[model samples]
Every structure is written in structure tokens, then in C-alpha cells.
Target: MRDRFLTGLIGYPIAHSAAPAMHEQAATALDAHCHYQLIEVAGAGRDDLRAMLEGVRRLGFAGVNVTFPYKEAVVDLLDELTPDARAIGAVNTIVVDGTRLVGHNTDATGFARAIAPLLATKSRGAIALIGAGGVGKAIAFALAGLGAGEIRIFDADAAKATELADQLQGGVAARSVATAVDGAAGLINATPVGMLPNRDTPVPDTLLHPAMWVADAVYSPLWTPLLSAANAKGATVLTGRDLAINAAADAFALFTGMTPPVAVMGNAFDAVMAARYSPSA
Candidate 1:
């Protein structure tokens, strides 16, 4: 039996990541010996990523979670990919087995599980998805799988948006944020905007409406500027908490062949948030 496991997350600007607490707490609850690290490499290009992954392979690390700019880029570096990861054209978790590196996507599954309950009785109307990057692609695929009526995507990089739209049926690359959000029943901010140290919002406050539901992928601040604005407008809002906890649990399961207690993970997330948002914090 493996007595200890070394896993980590690879991405830049990961100082605000809440994954460690969630994974560590879940490990404690499951009696699993695990050490989750944060490997930050700023402005890492393809070759830089190749070297980092090689290090992960040579070091005997069990697995690592890929994030931000690398989620899509790391796909080509892996030895194998789960169908979902390949189909989604992105990956968030990579498991190292012997000499082979396998890529899997828990973000799509995690977002689906997190947002399904909220949209249970709601119509699968048009959705405005901000950011056509890796997380945006995962959210788009997840929403498509959930039977979304239509998905309008907007990214500053028009080519990226067009590329993703071309791959997904019923997806459109809108001209602007307004063009995408217009008449949409749901909205999601899948970008790094509105994260801690960045108070920016993907969409303008005036564009948000009471009839639509809003979701943001930024969890560190918990109540991001976008969610706070949507909340002020009486729109039903979903935080990144659910998605974070669910994704971490799924990734933990993949990293260690053990089921983590979601409740325990949630508690850890709550504790971290509480400390992060406290007056003195």
C-alpha cells in the first residue's frame, strides 16, 4: 500500500488557490496520506510546461491539477487523455501512472454537478458565457450536455471564441459582451477576472437582469463583483464554491483512489473563505 502521495496544482498566479485546504481536509477525513503542493510558474511557454511536466513524471508524484493558461496547452504534453478531456479540448487534472501521463477533466463534470440543481426546473434557455478559454470551453460543453438551448460565447480574443464556437454545436461567437448577454437566460464568468486582487467584472452591471441567473468561476472572493452586482439586481446567483468543492472532490478521487467526504471538503472551503473574508484577514 502507498503510505504517502505527493500531488499538486500547476498554474500561474495560484497564490489565491483554495485547493490545498479542501484536498488536505478531505485526505484527513479519509485517512489518506497526501501532500498537495502549489507549483507556480509565471508566463510559462509550451517548452517551460514540457519541462515542468517532465519533472512531475520523474519525481514520482501521483498527479497534478492543471489550471489557467496551461489547462488547454497541457493537453498535447500528456501521454494519454480521457475522452471527456479530449472532447472538451481542455484538461484540469493529470494523473501520472508509471511512465505514462494521463489527462482528465473534472471541471466539466464538477460544473455540471454544481449547477444542475440550480437549473433543475428552469428552462434550458440561451446562456451567455463570458471567456472562451479553457474553463469557458468546459462550461460550454457541460451546458451543451445538459441540453442548453443555445450558448453565446464572447472572448477578447475573437479567434479563440470563434474556434470554440466552431467546435460546439449550437454555440455562437458573439461580437461583444452585450451581443452575447442579450436575451440570455443564464450567464457565467469563466475567466480570471473578478478573482482576488482583481475587482474587474466580465460583464457590465447594467447588462445583468433580474430574469436571468448569474454564475462566476472566481471563488476566492466568494462574492465577486459580478455576483454582487447580479445579486443587487435580484438575479438568482451561484457562487464558485459549489463548483470548486465538487471539482476538488472529483480531482481528489482521481489523485487517490479514495472517495473524499464532500461535507468535510465543504467545511474546509468555508473555513478558508471565512478567514479570507474576515475583517482582520
Candidate 2:
């Protein structure tokens, strides 16, 4: 039996990634003995990213999770992209089939799974999104697929937001955070604003209201300032934990061709969060 697997994450500021622990733990539980490393590169350009992907291919790595600033940019560098990835215009998971690197977007699938239970009650009427990069693109497409009436996107880069909106057809580009959240039924943060070491939020707490449901894609803290304020304001809240774990499970399946033990991954994620919050390191 093939008993070894090598996979990893590739992105900058990925010290907060739970991919290694989650994947390794799930694999170890199945006696596969997986090794998931973190390839943290800062300010990598297209050429640098090209080199890294080549290194992964040369080093016999199973695959790697592309995150943050690289997901969309990595699309053009891959050999092929899955239908979902092409539709979302982003790639969060890359599956290596021999020499072929196939890009896939598990972010959309993961977020859909994470928020499915709440969709019946929460308003999918109009959503305000804080990022227009890869994750945001996946979420917008996912919501649209799930029958969202409208997606209002706002990014620090107006062009990016406009681009995403143009793609969505049902999407709108909001000029400011205030405009984005104005009468929004739900607010979601797809940026890195509230992640650890950067204890800030993209939107002010005043914008959150009891009538809104909120979600954040940042799981480093699990409880980001944006979700925190939303929770405090009596809004329905969805943490990034479920989305992270679910996406990772899907990515693991692509990496190892085995059904991931999702419960084990969930436990691993809980452990990572516990250690992060534990006072006695």
C-alpha cells in the first residue's frame, strides 16, 4: 500500500495556516503518514511563484494549497483548471496528476458546505463583501450559485471590485464600506484584515446590525473582530473554521485520492485554535 503523502500550503503570511496540522492529522489517523509543509514566501512575483511551483513539481510534492494574494494569480500559471475553478476565476487547491498541475477551487465548495445549514434562515438577499480577490471571487460565485439575489463588492482596489462585479452580472461595486454594507442582509470579510498580528477589521463595528448575518474567511483567530462585532450585535455569525476544514478535507481528497476523515480534521482544527488561545504556551 502507498503509505506516504507530501502536500503543503504556498503563500505569504501563512504562519496562521492550519493546513499542515489538519491534513497531517487526518492522514496519520489513516496510517498514510502525510507531511504537509508551509511554503511561506513574502512578496513573491510571478517569476518567483513560477519557481516555487516548479520546485513543488520537481521535488515530488503531492500538491499545495494556494492562498491569499496568489490564488487568482496562480490560475494563469497552472497546466489546467477544473470547471469550478475556471468559473470562479480562482484556484485555491492544485492537484498534481503526475506532471500535470490541475487547479481547483475548494473555497467555493467549502464555504457552501459551511454556510449551507444557515441558508434557510439567513438572508441571501443582498450580501456585502469586503474583498474582491480570489476568496471573495469564490464566495461571490458560490453565493450566486446558491441563488443569492445580489452581491455587493467593495475592495481597496476599485478596479478589482469592478472586475468582479462585471463577472458576476448580479454583482454591484460599492464605492465605500458604508455603501457596501448599506442595507445589506449579510456582510462577509474575505480579506486578511482581522487575522492575527493584524488585530484590525475592514469594516467598522457601527456598520454591523442585528438584522444582518456575518461571515469571515479568516480562521487564524477563528473569531475575527468583524465576526466578533457582528455576534455582539445579535447578528447570525459563521466562523471560518468550518470553511477551512471543509476546504482542506476536499483538498486532501484531491491530494491522496482518499475520503478524508472530516471529524479528525475538525478535531485538529479545534486543537490548533485551542493552542492559539491557550495562555500557557
Please write out the lDDT profile of model 1 over residues 119-141, one tens digit for every residue. Answer: 89566778899988889999989
**Residue pairs in steric clash, candidate 1?**
none
In candidate 2, which residue ranges exceed 4 Å CA deviation? 171-175
| Model 2, TM vs. native | 0.96
Q: Could you give the C-alpha RMSD of every candidate to the true structure, in order shown?
A: 1.1, 1.3
lDDT of 1: 0.90
Global fold similarity of model 1 (TM-score): 0.97
After TM-score superposition, what is the CA distance of residue 33 in candidate 2 from its true location, in Å? 1.3
C-alpha TM-score for every candidate? 0.97, 0.96
- Poorest lDDT segment (10 consecutive residues) of candidate 1: 167-176
Q: Each candidate's lDDT (Cα)?
A: 0.90, 0.89
What is candidate 2's CA lDDT for residue 70?
Answer: 91
252: Cα error in model 2, Å: 0.2
